[model samples]
Target: MAITIALAGNPNSGKSTLFNSLTGSNQYVGNWPGVTVEQKTGKYKKDKEVHFTDLPGIYSLSPYTLEEVVSRDYLVNERPDVIIDVVDATNIERNLFLATQLLELGIPVVIALNMMDVVRKNNDFIDIKKLEKDLGCKIVEISALKNENIDKLIETAKSVAGQKKMTYQEFEEDVEKYIKEIEEFSVIKDNPAKRWLAVKLFEQDEKIMKEFPLYGKETRRLEEIIEEAEEKYDDDGEGIITDGRYNFVSNVTKDTVKKGRKGMTTSDKIDRIVTNRFLSIPIFVGVITLVYIIAINFVGGPVTDWVNDVFFTEIIGENFRGFLENAGTSEFLTSLLVDGIIAGVGAVLGFLPVIAVLFLFIAILEDIGYMSRIAFILDRVFRKFGLSGKSFIPILMGTGCSVPAIMGTRTIESDNDRRMTIMTASFMPCGAKLDVIAMFAAFLGGSWWYAPIWYFGGIMAVVVSGIILKKTKYFSGDPAPFVMELPEYHMPSARNIFKATWFRCKAFIVKAGTVILLATVAVFLLKSISLDGHFVDFNADPEDSILAGFGKIIAPIFAPLGFGDWMASVATILGLVAKEIVVGTYGVLAGIGEVGAEDSSMVALVASKFSVASAFAFVFFNQLTVPCFAATGAIKEEMGSNKWFGLAIGYQLLFSYTVAFMIYQFGRVIEGGSFNLMTGLAVVVLFIYGYLLFRKDRSKLENKNFSNKENDEVVKYESN
Candidate 1:
């Protein structure tokens, strides 16, 4: 028989590291059953028969969130042969709460005490043998990161899987006499771990309490026992069970665990500097700036330029066009292949290195545990703006892709909070938006501030949106308190960072090569084809072509935002496939395709065509749009309706356009520059919308017969 082993543990107990080590390249990540929460499962490296299911890192089997529910459901329905409960050796007292709960499930469990190296370094000691005796399970020490003693852990897991069933008895007192009575009832006599089941029932765990049907007549007796226990404890079932588990964990820890009198370890000392109360913000800014400079300027620029100019612009583009011309290939087909597909999609794909580097840094921060500390440090600041501190992770990850960042909103528990997070998550420039930013940075403006400015624009949008939305009646709740387990700081594995970077970069390539490529070819066909034999050069003048004509109609609409150029206008039309392509489209249509060199040459080409103010406005519009296909799909999935998704997109477009229009019009005046008539009108219209957004729309009242304040508030809230 194939043995199924479930690895269960608290978050940051080195569970993921252990899973990565045991599975190596054998693991697959996907959804668990019907839930949106991601599930990771893999076969043991050498032991194919010993399949491992990596359960979500959770505190207990409580059904409060999708993760906990999925984990609890899997354990009850699948009933793995053995569970390797990974625990942090340094934080055994807190970690054992989950361990103790897992034991009650009546499955054979082996304690994989991870991070033993950290424990030893901290001068803390754990009596492994004593812990085994206390929990009635095998205890094995392993450093999942270092790959130490992992083989022994697997061996012990195999042994436990083959052995007869062993169940853990509760170590804490039974405050409820009825809980004990329920365990003793005749209906529960056959249960292997009646005491554990009884505790869960008393704790009123919906999963367990609802299972009383299996007990039949004894179910009534169980309920009576639970009532008596509830009265005696003077607390609900969940609280009672929670307190009991904590009490038991505390006793076990007191007896077997000891902390050295040592002041601070090397990591703690480093953390003080990195996560310092006052200096942390400056340090974070400095670190992020350094990351962007290295990635965009040093690494991404050279690599991306090579991919764009060398591979596409020169080699493939010129060679292919020349070959086709020599062979007397049709003009339409040549344009479609060279400019439409290659220049359009290839331009987007060229920025993969920049996005990959950004994602790599994010993964490093998360894996090393600094991400959580950043959250804790920023919680107070973020809360002041009516956004949760947890929102920082999604926004930070948004630097890579907004799809996952929006999906990360599922981690937020409050309904209003989740909605606000989803709305602002895409405000951060995602990998897709990087194409536009890089394009503008290279072509329109050449300054180190270009990249950082886009980043600050994204962040400012979030903060400003939060403040504006909070003042409204619909989103007027205080920010939810942030709660999360702080994982021990450790050296991040290069392998993990590389894997994460590759994953995001690969997604970008697939999207550009497939979706963006098809869209660009379509645009090319529309622009190049004509019934007459007149050879119209679409590149010289885009206005006379189909794409240009289409953009011309919309150009007047966006004239107020300062970018009425057909190239900029048409690029926005193609932005629906992905945002970054807008910049690449601009680069091609702006007649910068002939630039030979990488960084400086490309910058020179862009600067000659557009001003800095217009460039900033262009990037702003792209930043505030309803993201790409992937992110839109994610929002729909997370919100569970098209209505919410539509609202999210509509709000973003309105907000983005208003901001861009303001900056372009008002900013020009501040710079002592003359403004266009349409731009001034656009600004005036936005002012009205801004006023209506924050205040009552009294115009609707004249037509309506009557309205309730509650109904009006609801309508206003949903509109926002």
Candidate 2:
């Protein structure tokens, strides 16, 4: 039989580092069943039979969040052979809170005191033998990051698992007396942790109270006992139990742990500036700007140019065209192969280097713990717009992919905030959309600053949309309080950063081979066939193609946005399949066959088709529009209502269209162009948008019926 051990701990307690060290390369990651929370399991590096399940990093086994519920259910139902509770030795007090809860689950536990290097470096010491004696569990000190004493920790955990003996710790006298009484009177015989269940009963854990079988009179008597205890302690029953556990932890730590000087640690000194009130946002902006500048222009630009000019255009396209001509290939077939397929797919793939560099920079930021500080600094600003800083996490994740970002809203507790976040998260440009942005920036003179401009534009889209939606009745509500622990800032591990960047870039590459490939093929075929009769010849104008006919039907709708041409309309429509297809379709329609070393024809073709203002409008429209079908499905699943999903899609389309329209029409007006009907419509739309932006929130209106009530009466009514 496989020996199973579960790893549980508070968030940022080095639990992940320990799991990575123990499991090495033998790990599988997926979501917990029926929840979006991540679950990880792996086999020990040395012994394949020794399986380790890394439970979600949770502070306690309370059923408040999905992660907590999943962790609690797994521990109670699966009942691993041994529980390895990894605790951060530097922050032992807070970590011990979870350790104490894990010990109460009636399973043999081995405590892995992680980050001992940090502790030792700070001149702190923990008496391992004394801690083991006091906590009734085997203890091992190990630096998971440094791979120190890992073998001993694993051996000790396996031995404890083999013993299969439960470890119990005594609580306060009053709490212990009530727990024993409840256990004796309880009829839950199958539960191994009867005392723990009784303690949960006293703490008024709603899930336990609902699931555990107890007589009606016994339930009433249990509540009475809890109330009497609360009265005696001058605190709620849950608070009393929490205090008792802390008291026990204090006794253990006071005897076994030695503290070092703590005026200001390195992390604190850094946080003082990074998390400062006035400097935080500007610093964040500078960091993001620097990342984009380096990725798009400085490092990634030359590599992308080579892929496009040398690899795809000169080498692949020219050689294939030469071979086709030598083999007497049909003119139509040659056009389909070179002008249609390779051009379209290659246009998107040429930017793969840029995407990889961008993902690498973002991964480094995340690994260094600066991303969390971005959330911490933005919380106050988010609250003013009726959103919690927690919403920023999903928005940040959206930069990679909107599907996961939409699902990430599960962490936000408020329904209105979560739904609003789901609706707006896709406004951030995802990896697929980056191809379109890169192409547009290249068309607009290859300026590096366009990258940050579009990025900041996406963020502003999210923020402005958040503020607007909050005033509407469907989304109007106070956001939940933001509370999150800031992990200590440290140098990012190169291995972890590379792994993350590789995985993200690999996903993009896979999509390029699969979804983007299919979309490009379809676009090529559509543009190759002629509406006049049959397929078009090699030199035939693409305007007569079947795609142009369809594009003409939808072209009028985008006339106000200035890209009313058939090709631009067609590309915009195909973008719904995949955003990268927008650029791919342009490459196909431009028909710059057999691009040479200095291939400026395609860029010139795009420049001729769109002015700078219209190009910006086109990019903005695609960036802010409803995301691809996969993200829509996620929105539907997360919103749990087709009505809300439809509303979200409608909102995205309307907002993007309105913004794009204003950019083009008003831009033309500023250039001393003629004032047309479309320009007048843009003025009207702007006025309505401004009205909505400044509109009073109907939800905040006072009601006479409620306001007329006396304060004491209102208080009494609410209490009852």
Candidate 3:
């Protein structure tokens, strides 16, 4: 039989490091299943036959959070042969709580005391024998990062998998009585040491109770015990169970562990400074500014430009155009390769360097555990606007792709918060948007700051919009309470960091190749086809051409926003396929042949018609609009109904239009003159939005039945 071993611990417990060390496979390292939360797993490299399941990192088995529930279900249902519970040796007291519950599952377990180096460095000591005696499990010391004693850990786990199962730690008199009573009805009744199941039954885990039915008297008996304990504990039965587990761990630690008599250490001292009440925010801003400067201005900008111009433009451009010229390729085929595919998707691919750098930094922050602090620091301020600090993660991820960013909203517990988060997450500039922003920056703004400015603008958009929406009837709610564990920081592995970079970069390429390919082909088809003796797109006036004809029909609609040019209209229409395609569409319409790095021919054409303000407005509109088709699908799946999906899309479009109108009108007004009477109508719309934004309460939209129920509850409770 294969020796099955499960690696388990709290988030950032070096579980991933240990798994990678043992498995040598980078199979799993995504933000989350449907959220920005990280997920990881791998199999042992040394012993492929020895199955290793890396369970999600969680604090405990209580179903208080989604991750905890998912983890608990896997452990209970899957029932691995042996569990190697990795404990952060430095934070043993807290880490042991999970281990204590794992012991109760009645599976053979070997405790891997991780971070022992840190423990020894801190002048702390844990009597391994004493700990083993107290917890009734084998304990092995190992440093997951340095790969020390890792082999010893695997050997011990293999040995234990072949060994007989161990019994759970005995509970207190009252807890033990209920344990016995519930065990009588449990499917694992033949095995009498299932202490945690009994406690879960007493705490009224519906899933557990359903699995093990009992007589009326027995059922009532369990309920009576749970109710009486709840009253005595002054908390819910679940809370009581949690308290019991922690208390048990505390007792075990008191005898075996000792801390050196010392003042605040280096880590604590640094934490005080970094996490300071007043200094943290400003410092964080400065840090972010510095990061952007390094990423966009210094590193990513030059490298991306090189990739765009040299690799994409010179190399790919020359070869593709040469092939077309040599083969006597048809104007349609030439345009498809040179304009549609190369220009559209290639434009987006140009910014891969910039995205890689940004994602690398994000991965580092996450691995080192600083990202959680970001949430904690922002929680209080964001709460006033009906969003939790947790909303920041999705917004941050949106800088890479809105598809995952929209999905990240699932982590938000409140349906209202989740919906609002989904609506706004994509407002932040993603990798696809970065290409457009980079294009404008290089071609229009003639400054490096422009790229970073777009990112900054996207972030500010979400925040300001969040604040406005919070006061509206549609978005009224209190932010969820913020509670999270701060894991001990560690130096991130190069392997893991690079793996993350590849993961995000791969997503970008996939979009460029697949979705953008289809969209470009569609654009080619639409722009080609017959009319007169001419290849209409190549020879005809842009206005009379197929793309131009469609744009002309919609051109008047966007005239108010200052981009009245038909090409701008066409680009916006193409944006429905993908946001990045707008830049590519510009290349095609400008009659630029395989647009290269040195080529500003198409950009000049766009500039002749559009002012800087109008260009910014155009970018802004696309940035905040209903995201790419993939994100829309994610919204539909996550919302789980078309009505809610429509609401999400409608709200996004409405918000995007409102902001674009404001920027165009307000900026134009300050610049003075050439304003039309329709500007007055836009001004009126702006006023209504202002009322929605600044109003003390959301009264106008509160009557809608689909308004967030959680937010309604919060509004009602707050009023009381």
Candidate 4:
């Protein structure tokens, strides 16, 4: 028979590291049975008969968060043959709460105490024998990160798999009374999860109550037992149970663990300045600005300049055109292949170096554990706007891609909060938009402030949107509580950082070769064909081409925000397909097809046609707009309906246009142009924004108007 093992633990306990080690490359990843939460199962590399399931990390076996529910449901329904409980040894007291609950399910469990290296370094010692005696389970101390004693851990777990069955931990006398009665009177007396079910019933868990059917009088009797216990403890059932578990964990740690003198660690010392209430926001802003400066201006800029100026413009374009013409190819086919596809795709690929640097910094922050601290520092401010730091995490995750960022909102408990996060998370410029940002920075002669301004401007938009929308009736509510474990700071792993950077850059390069290549060819055909359907030379009568006529029809819509020319208008519209293609479109329209067009490059070409005001507005609009089709599908899936998806897209477009309009009109005046009608209109837009920002919160209204299934389920979920 195949032996199934479930790995369960709290978040940040190094459970995933162990899973990766045990499974090697044999893992299979997919969704949970009926939910969107990810599920990972793999056959052990050493022994295929020993299958492992990596459960989502959770604090307790309660249906609190989606993760906890999925874990609890799997443990109960599947009843795996054994469990390896990965516990963070440095924080054993808090971690033991989950370990205590896991014992009650009657599955044989082996506690794999992780992070023992950190414990040893801190001068703390834990007695393994005493802990095993108290918890009545096998224990092994290992470091998942260093792969220390991993084989020993699995061997011990296999020995305890079916040979030993551990009973639930005993409670204090006061609580023992209710438990003894539950064992005698419970309906699931013969069930495998009898003890666990009995405890859930005593805690008055609604989900658990719904599961085990009890008639009217039987339910009232159980309620009486719960009420009496609550009266004695002076706490609700959930509180009473949670306190009991903590109390037991406290006793176990006190007896078996020896601690060193209390002093702040290095991570704690750094947090003092970085997380200081008054200085944190400014310090965060400074750090991000410095990162962008390094990536865009210092590190990635000179290389990209060479790629655009020397590589694409000099080598590829000139050589490819000459060779094609020499081979007796027609001018039309030669231009279509070289000018249309090569120039456009080359324009986007020129910025790949910058994206690699940006992704490297993102991976480093994640590995160093500062991302959690950033979220922690922002929680107070986020709460004031009817959101918590939980929403901000997904926004940070959007730095990679918007799909997973939108999907990350599932962990937020409130419907209003989840919907708001999903709507605004894409406001951040994803990896796809990094090229557009770099293009603008290059156009400005590689100005250091250009990238940071565009990057942080997107974050500020999310914050400001949250503040304004929280006042509306449809979204009025208290925010979801944010609970996160801030891990200790450490040096980033170079291997992990490079792996992350390569995957993101690889995806970008793949898209450039396929989607972007096709899109650029289509653009070339449109611009080369005239209104009467004959091929027209772009060097002569470029305005009479089909693309120019089509762009002319939609150019007036964007006139208020400047960039009313056909090229800029067409680029902005095509960005909806993929943001990277915006830079490609500019390359195509620059007329790089004609000889001697080399020195007047794409960025140089665009700069000659646009003033500073219109160019800045063009970049800013793409930064805040709905990212692409994939992200839109993510929004629709997470929002659960066409109505909410439509609202999200509508909000994004209107917000992007309004901000771009202000930037253009105010910027024009700042550049020494006299105030015009559009400048006065910008003032009116600012006044409307002030009204929205200062508005009072409205009462929560019935949400029956919009059909959202997640809304009803979220309302029913208990927030713990």
Specify the highest-TM-score model's number: 2
Tens-digit per-residue lDDT, 1-720, candidate 3: 577788889876788788878887634555434443445555677766777778777888877777777677667777878899989898899999888788888778899999998888878999999999889899999998789899999888888875565756666677677667777764557652356777778778777777767667776777787787777768887777777777788898999999974788766776797789898887767666666666676665567667766776678877888888889998677777776677666666766777678788877877776777776777756666666887887777787788888877766777677777787888988777766766676556445456467667887788877877677556677766667667666677787788877888898788778877777666665666443424565444555556666777899988878887778888887786788788767655554544556655556776787777687888899898888878878788777778888987888888787778777877777777566776787788878867766676544355454467767888999999
Q: What local distance difference test score does each model get?
A: 0.75, 0.84, 0.75, 0.85
How far off is residue 493 in model 2, in Å? 1.5
Alpha carbon lDDT of residue 170, candidate 1? Answer: 59
lDDT of 4 at 543: 86
- Report the C-alpha lDDT of model 1 over 1-720, residue by residue, as the tens digit: 688899999877888889988988898887777766778889888878778899987888888777799888888778888889999888788889888878877788899999898888877888888888988899999999889999999888888785666756453465645566677766465676576777776666677766654467676766776676678778777777787778888888899988874687776888789878788888877777776776676666678778778877788778888998899998767776777677776677777777777778778887787877777777757776567887776776687888878877776767777787888898888878877776665564346666676776788788778767766655666677778876767788887788887888888888887777777666666566433434467565545666667777888867777787766787787787678667556544533335554443445545664566677787888888778878888888887778777888888888888888877787667667876785678678777757745663233342343556667988999999
The local lDDT score (0 to 100) that residue 257 gets in candidate 3 is 95
Q: Give the TM-score of candidate 4.
A: 0.92
Candidate 4 wrongly placed segments (more than 4 Å): 21-30, 42-51, 184-186, 216-224, 231-236, 315-330, 538-541, 591-600, 700-720
Best by lDDT: 4
TM-score of 3: 0.86
Candidate 2 structure quality by residue, lDDT tens digits, 177-293: 888788876575457767577778888898988888678889788888888898889998889888888898888899999988669988899989998989988999999999888
Cα RMSD, each candidate: 6.1, 2.8, 5.1, 5.5
Model 4, span 1-720: residue lDDT tens: 679999999899999989988998899987787777778999989999989999998999888888899999999989998989999998899999999999999899999999998889989999999999999899999988788999999888888777545666888686777776776555778788778888888887888888887777777888898888888889987788888889899999999999874888878899999899898899888888887888789865678877766777678888888899899998888888888998899888888888888889988998888888888888977777677899998888998888889988877888898899998998888888888888777668777677788768888899888988787876677788998998888787787678778888898999999889998998889999999999887566568889899999999998888888888889888888889889899888875544343354677778776788888888888888877888888899889889888989999999999999999999999999999888999999999999998776655333432336566667778552
Residue-level lDDT for 690 in candidate 4: 91
Q: Which window of 10 residues has the lowest lDDT sum in candidate 3? A: 530-539
Best of the two (1, 4) by TM-score: 4
Q: Runs in model 3 with CA error above 4 Å?
A: 16-54, 120-123, 143-152, 162-164, 173-188, 191-193, 202-213, 216-243, 299-305, 319-336, 446-449, 467-475, 521-534, 537-541, 591-599, 698-720
Clash counts for the predictions, in order: 2, 0, 2, 0
